[model samples]
Target: MNRPRSTCLAVALVATILFQPGARAQVTGAQVRDAIADAVRHLKARQQPDGSWRSRDRYEHGYTCLATLALLLAGEAPTSPPMARALNVIAHAPDEYTYVVSLKIMALAQADPEKYKEDIERSARWLMRAQDESGLWSYQLNPVNYDHSNSQFALLGLNAAAQAGVKVPAGVWQAARRRVLTTQNSDGGWSYTFRGSSYGSMTAAGVSDLLILGGAVVSPVERGVRNGVAPGCGRYREDKPLLNGLRWLGREFSAIQNPGHGRSNLHYWLYAVERCGILSGLQMLGRHDWYREGAAKLVSDQRADGGWGTIENTCFSIMFLAKGRKPLLVQKLQWSADDDWNPDRNDLEHLLDRIGDKLGEPMSWQSVPFDAPLERWLAAPLLYMQGHKFPEWTPNQREKVRQYVEQGGTLFLEACCGREDFRNGAEAFLAETFPLTPLHELDSGHPVYHAYQDVAPAGLMGVDVGCRTSIIYSPFDLSCHWEQANIPLLGERAFDLGLNIAAFATGRRPLRDRLDLVKVAEREDINEPPPPGDPLVLAQVEYHGDWQPDPHALAHFAEYLNEQAGLRVAASARATRLTPEELPRAPFLYMTGHYAFELSGKERAALAAHLRRGGFLFADACCGRREFDASFRAMLRQVAPQGELRRLEPTHPIFSGSPGFRIESVGYRAAALAENPNLSRPELWGLETDGRLAVVYSPYGLGCGLDGHACYNCRGILEADARRMATNVVLYALTR
Candidate 1:
């Protein structure tokens, strides 16, 4: 077989360049999801009356187990009709072959481990009994012919079983780990048996087996690095056989075809690649984004019927997409060239594992370079950086970090080992990156301390960007404790603090992958300048306080108006003061801030005169800050002393659908709902002048939501509702 040299170049190019904003415009998260949905419909249609998807004769049970596992991983509920029927079939099916039994165990364990505990234990024991002295499995027990493929499935089943509370002896994992290490060829790849040429499928299988056996939960030995000797740390390390296998696979990686075996068992190879990537906590292996490249291939290869090929192939494809597409919760940043930035290499993986177990959902994380594109950084809501020393960054990289935070990404800075150098550098970096926003020490009562796990008095400092605290800095070592999961109370505290930060940053919301937020060509129109036909110039009022908390809010709202209301708004909003000269240039004025400031008497008189002249002003307290709220109310009273600022009832025309969809009720952020559980109605106050509502106000935040960013602790309306409300307010300002 002639290996293609271009494959290496393709992977390198994807790694280095394709992560830019609009590089891979054709492939998007939504498109991948739609393809998966289409494949799911195809699978549903292919289900037989017996709930088993038909395959080759006598392999029906194995295929059924595979299909059921795929569907379960694909977000299908166990109570769904097809899944229920499949489960029933799996329960009664005779487990004669090793493959079928392993697959059945996997499916049952995934469906409901507690409920299927007994069945999983039975299958796990069967697998243990079937293991040969060499720690490999074959088609049958005590078989003469053992293969890596069967061993891989057996390990997968046992791992799942172990996760579901079934006890498998440590010796079994040790023996398996030893066998794979010894079997690795000098070329760093694995063959079918111990003699054939190395191929992609077996190499992937080998890598995945090592990952499972050396997993944080399953490894029997201590997790350390020590010359790769006997009884060494079973966890993955730099100089390990696992890395060697990964290197081999990476050298020959191909998403479209199984290397050394063209177009055969392709989906199976892809599935193994997903397992390897996810288990290793790696986003790129030898310059290849295994998930991205493979997902694009599978999506394009999906047939009209949605099946990749045979029943087995389709099952593998589904599993690859479903499990691989799991959103990333955090991206550990590689800030420096050396290991200082990652003293505790597995810190994030261990932290995410604990968080996932606590939340009862799987979470994913990866490490990307600091210079990776803004789009890549935005893949996860949180970007984590830690080091013992100050890491250097270019001007462009510093700007990218700021852009990431501005684009709804949170920056988490930690001083590893409580290093003073790192802490000083972090503070300086924040100061430089956000010169206008100063860091403030978070009190014990801050939500970061209690967002999920209460770790009160946890010393943390933060910087508020836009409507949220976008920068969280810890001037102490937490990753070290996270790496040492066996540390007494310290480990638990570290995990708790880490989980709290994640929850506070993400609001426990479902995250999106990089592809999900890729800028497509169709959205380019939003940034294009509006045609010169009396375009509405949305104006933001500048003031003494932090008036422009969210710089993009007005522009995004303008885009929203253009898209939703067919209004021709200028591409950019104009920032102006409350001078008479500037007030008349735009009829609609938006003002929001996070601090308190009183308008000058002259400016107040100009604003009041503008309102009296039929100009409309919309103001909200950014992030629902009380300071801004109180000051705005006082300013309103001063500006319109005679006109009472009364609450607009649900019966008001604005809520009654005069301008946009009737919003009798709107969704508020979790923080808002926590404060006021019964807050379903729009909370707005209006002041009328000359029998027309000239000024509208909201104590809650609208700017952050209008900017289309996640503000976890913002006591404000949800994004969708905020945009809708802004739409209604804009229409009201224009028409009324």
Candidate 2:
């Protein structure tokens, strides 16, 4: 009761309980796929004129057979030409065939039993004839002594025969069991004929054989494979010999032998782990990182052809890569909706680089964030970065933008706080120069919100935030340099308006396409040293390396624009670095740390006039903000009455967008996402204007309050405010 059965029972118990919920799966499915791929490569390499591994007189038939079996287990269709050829060669091979072809063929036939019925039947007969009267088939048909490899192969083959309904001679099983017992050394281990090499691989195989054939507990074979005997058992001396075998196999596999190699055998070793089900045994052996190391090696061994070769190297390489698939294909995110604060920026590359550093393991597949339009953010989020400006558009850019807009586009613009001296600085466009469409706040109940719902903040912030990747805001904004009067402000108006424009324009296209056409709008507050669209002061961002736009990539270029280029209105949407389908619906989309569309054409002049027209503006930190706000103010001039954008009150209509007036945004004095449920609706909460003066305005969480203007309680929160603020803005745009 307390013997061999316990160990076998343990193996069974582990298998059963190991798959429970949260019980991390073993050797992920991908590893298996890769291992199978490796087997295919090996078989492919072995293919000869007959479509099998046989070099005219080379006599590597056994190796070829082994390779075929491995590939067959990989789902290589037997009817397939390569397999058919291999089978043909095997049929014509010399006599005395014995490499467990029957067992290997089992997997091949299982895929389509009828097609390989004759093959299986023939193999069964071959095995029966190959078996000796003593029940065991040793190496090359005859053996002097009994022990691990040879004995286990016979049992394994016979076991397969039994499973397939192939008949074996009477008393065969009983005799094999007895033969195993006789070979058992005093210590519970069994020695090879003369006791040579002992190792884990051999021991594992032995354990499998005993379990498959003995059908008894505490069988001498069980101890022989598992822990080895204490010393004295019976007269066989098999115990020491078996332990020695395991030692040999273990050292053999573990020994880092790179013998002047163009490629190491590590890959094959990994393949063998899976092929031999060593992964299961390793787990039981408590080798936690064993599989991971194997995976790492696999990654290093990949060839240009995307396939593996050799039974020893390529096998492990493919299996290891496949095993690590779960983690590799995991696709991580930097900012989850559940975060305490929402970040604003348009730099996707920065986020990618950060996460890439943390991945530890390299990813083999292509993954992107947000499969939908870029403008569907939950809030009218802002994108802010420092220093660099976009490169001048190529000859095709104007056409692209024109085409993009005619289809439907909404781009917003604004002045920076640091450059607020210029009048009508952040207008949609310079009415005096480039007269493009003047961007007014979009009309209330516009299609932007209605794309998914008719109301504001329909899905909590409503719909989805569309911020597929992590976002960041600028550390230094507010740089007013307009010849006209400039106001100090981080134009939330511009950001929101831009969102509507982009959504209306590019929603039909993809985020990637839209990113291709956008040009950073010149801040109306800043009169450029040169003309806007200066080729000398521009950059480019693209996925493939061929184009190498002057701006380089999004993360680098956008950050440069935000920090060094003194860019006020930036348009940054990074595809490879960030995934954007995570946030709630908003008018404008922000990235790692930048905004899109500063201001161009008539929009710039309109903004200038709008400010002079006493229009109000709101801004705030979406995520961590002290630096972002500081940078934003640096770009403002008289643009904002005060060089600041503070919170508003519950009475603000922007808060009216959703049911709950509460502003539980990502960043705030405290967070309200917890207590607030009805967060999606429409209400007017910010500034209600009659086009007179900027005297009456509230800076709720949406942001307001500065110099001469003071918002009550720094934009007090209400029961239902975000929706109201949204409604208020729509109404403002409609009337203004």
* TM-scores of all predicted structures: 0.86, 0.36
lDDT by residue for model 1 over 17-132, one digit each (tens)? 22222233246788778877887888888899979877676665888899899889888999898999999999887767788998999999889988888988888888998999
Weakest 10 consecutive residues of candidate 1 by summed lDDT: 1-10
Cα lDDT for residue 587, candidate 2: 19
Candidate 1: count of backbone clashes, pairs at least 3 residues apart or interchain: 0
lDDT of each: 0.78, 0.33
The TM-score measured for candidate 2 stands at 0.36
Q: Which regions of candidate 1 deviate over 4 angstroms? A: 1-25, 44-51, 55-60, 79-85, 92-95, 185-187, 215-237, 357-361, 518-534, 579-585, 605-614, 633-646, 649-652, 669-677, 688-692, 709-715
> Tens-digit lDDT track for model 2 on 386-457?
121222334453343232222222222222221222123322112322232232333354444433224332
Whole-model lDDT, model 1 = 0.78
Quote the lDDT for 344 in model 1: 63
